[model samples]
Target chain A: MSVGASINARGLTKSYGSGEGAFHALGPIDLDIKPGEFVSLIGPSGCGKSTTMLLVSGLEPPSAGSIAIDGRPLTKPITEIGIVFQDHLLLEFRTAMKNVLLQQEIRGLDRAESRQRAEHLFARLGLVGAEDRYPWQLSGGMRQRVSIARALVHDPSMLLMDEPFGALDAISRTQIRHDLEMLWLETRKTVLFITHSIDEAIGLSDRVFVMSRSPGRIVDEIKIDLPRPRPAHLGEYPDFAAYTKRIYSVFEKLGVYKFD
Target chain B: MSDQIAPVTSPPTPAARLIRAGWLWSILNSVLSVVIFLALWEGLIRLFDVPVWLVPKPSDFLGRFLVDYPEILRNALATSVTLAAGFGLGVVIAVPLALLMVSIGALERGLYPVIVFLNIMPKTVIGPILIIWFGVSPLVSVLVVFLMCFFPVLVDSMHGFRAVDPRLDYITRSMGATPWQAFRYVRLPASMSHIFAGMRIGIVKAVEGVIIAEFIGSSAGLGFMIMRASSFMNMELLFCGLVAVAIVALIFNALLATSERIMMPWVRPR
Candidate 1:
């Protein structure tokens, strides 16, 4: 029971608008994520990866499906899940320390312990001097790292990130990806990550779920059998390249070769 | 493979360059503008031999203002007190009212239009009515300032709260924050810059409202002094009263700018 919680979503679907303009954003599909596994959902735009993330995080209810975490039905937002959006979304008035402690305030948890934990998390995220810095005072990369720190401060069992590094430059993107990989290795929390980049999916995920567009659903699932504590540069490895090629081939089938 | 790393010195942005305009230059430009305006005023008065009764020379106005400084200061203080009281009350009331309006769609439908209707009426009509009700007491001046400040704040707060990033609001909900906690911790701070901007406008309006109230009913503020001096044909005193009003406006503005800087240090004070 104390192990990282797994997600089981059955017949999950999401539809927007009404009548003639009705749009099915996500699937009548089934998905399962095992405990302590790192799963990546990679797809083209409008493949409903974000919609799927929202459903599992319990922020949005499915049109006709059920999502249970560790065999328990999740009706609303539970404390065991942490989510990071694309933007930092830090309160400009608050410091990084205060922003991280916002989770504690929401849950009415112990302040002193939460503050101690927040500081520890910040240090772990390489934000050693940023605890007192306001969001504007930090650079874009630093701000993004602070956002990651805020999400992980509560120490949730499951972490859902929707393209957290999507907004960064090439250099920062590579750097943050390395940081994320190391963090995941140390924590081994059940992570469900969404990204549009095939390389990011193949580089970080143990299991990658490739989705199809136009009433989005999972089309293919690939497991990267690369060894744990893997090499720093994923592209240098032949097996990583093989995994990436297969995922891109799925995109060609779906006619999403634009970015490939 | 080459081990050499490239230097990462990025070019400065245009906005960063614009902010490099020094404070000394800013102050010098302002002072030069005032000097030129005073020179023109002095030249016109002396050349036209304008009657002191109709348009007192700048020299005459300055001298008389200095002589009547004590009386002017008293009236200015009285007017400022009213403005402060009203401005404080306006923010306290309007922020909560706006929170109520934005949080519940039904209440917004029921009450927002009525609020708009009340705000649309020119305070000129409302001033006399308020004076009639409160009757020459200091309370009349306070009420008018409150009325002048109330609408802008209510409208601005409503806009700010409603315009908060929905994604950020979703974060609060997912974090298990109560609605009140969300408003206090997230929505209110998110809209702080807008709220302060509204308060600046409210401060200016509060000053105008108090003067109007004083002119219409009371006999204890700069507006009342202006009226009294004009009726008696003491042109210098009238000029002095007007100067007092200008000084008060500047003081109020400076105070607000200072507080804005203190509260939102992220926004470099302009």
Candidate 2:
């Protein structure tokens, strides 16, 4: 099965509040994501990367403009989109396997098949022995992995991850990043990953979309032409530093960083 | 490699052992205290040659209870039935009211202050009024119990529902869970401890409510037996009636604790 979905946004805009109090969070922006592509959205805080993901996932409607997924207008419920957040957000009362099965429950999938799928996903995520453990019993990294397993349990074509590893320690963050990259490579799902770390975006993304603050819009798009099966040691490469330097320059030009 | 993995065996701490022994020690202490008090009373009665009608010795009370055990048991059953009916009714009424309070902000704002005022009012004063309206029937007694028990359950459930983590709601919504699903999976399960806490208090109040209603009007329950014994200065029978009430309350509370344990095995009692 082809695990990809084309996403289109034309003049997408989102605002909070009304009239005098209205604050624009995003465009009037246009973008396109080809199927099976890994895209990372990088920007300063309040640049609306998170808001853009929310709009694209059909959790919230765009204030203006249009969004389409797989050539269908994204007006109704978009069941094919998977979303993960900064917080693990696992239900503390449920076991890891049960939490993963929640996607099947919400999507109205058959019980026996969903449970089998959940077990397979848990095994693939290296949580085979810990399926019955509750969220509170697991470490932070383990809990976040459970969240990922839950997001992918239904085999969603598009995965929207907003700072999914932000709460992990440095070591766990690196490990999860490697795991995520391998998962992406194997599944070839269209991924929209949002993060603040330029290194993470450069390390994982096929393309990076950088945004400007205060009425957010995509200000720069950088293609990472690094080889497939990128090594963890690629961060040490001169080319990786060059890409980081270019993205940092965009941030500098946007006045997102102040030296004085 | 052997040093890398330590064996995970440790003896129970002194604190854990103490906690394990705590309940037995408390029960023994309580028994000792009651025994000493009863011995003192018996000695006083024997030495002073007081009339049995004035103040019954422990033996006298126990003897009367044993002789009329069947009658006492029957009356106790009547009281227990009334308590169950009233408490069940109160819980049924309060839970929906609490859910309504969570769903409708305007309704909550309008009703909460009035509920607080009603809760603080002297509920005992309404006992006579209920008797007059429903005429010493089981319905009147049950209604009284319901009135006494309803407010605490309502207030606690409302607080519990309101206390559901907003982040969890966001998670549920993002997962495409409907409003009912959010309530069933997130809000209701999250509020389990609070609801049970309310029920624990409400059960006690329900027992008290039934006794008070019976004391005011009815002639069948332990409350009625106590009233009659007090009027005739039969202190032994009165003490027996009081003991029956205490035992009923104890049993009800124990059942509530057991049910809570079953429902929320994950929650540890502090």
Best by TM-score: 1
Model 2 chain A is weakest, by summed lDDT over 10 consecutive residues, at A121-130
- What's the TM-score of candidate 2 when only chain A is evaluated? 0.96
Which portions of model 2 miss their true places by more than 4 Å? B1-57, B173-176, B268-270
What stretches of model 1 exceed 4 Å from their correct place?
A1-3, A258-260, B1-48, B63-67, B115-117, B268-270
**Whole-structure CA lDDT of model 1:** 0.82
The 10-residue segment of model 1 chain B with minimum total lDDT is: B1-10
Per residue, candidate 1 scores C-alpha lDDT tens digits across B1-270 of 011112333324434533443333444665688678878988999999999999987788878767888998899898889888888999999988988888899999999889889899877577777777888878888888898999898888888888888888667877888888988898887888888878888888888898888898887989899989989999989988887887688778767765765566555323
Specify the CAPRI tier of model 1.
acceptable
Q: lDDT score, residue B200, model 1? A: 84
For model 2, the DockQ equals: 0.22
Q: How does residue B260 of candidate 2 score in lDDT? A: 69
Candidate 1: residue pairs that collide: none
TM-score of 1: 0.88
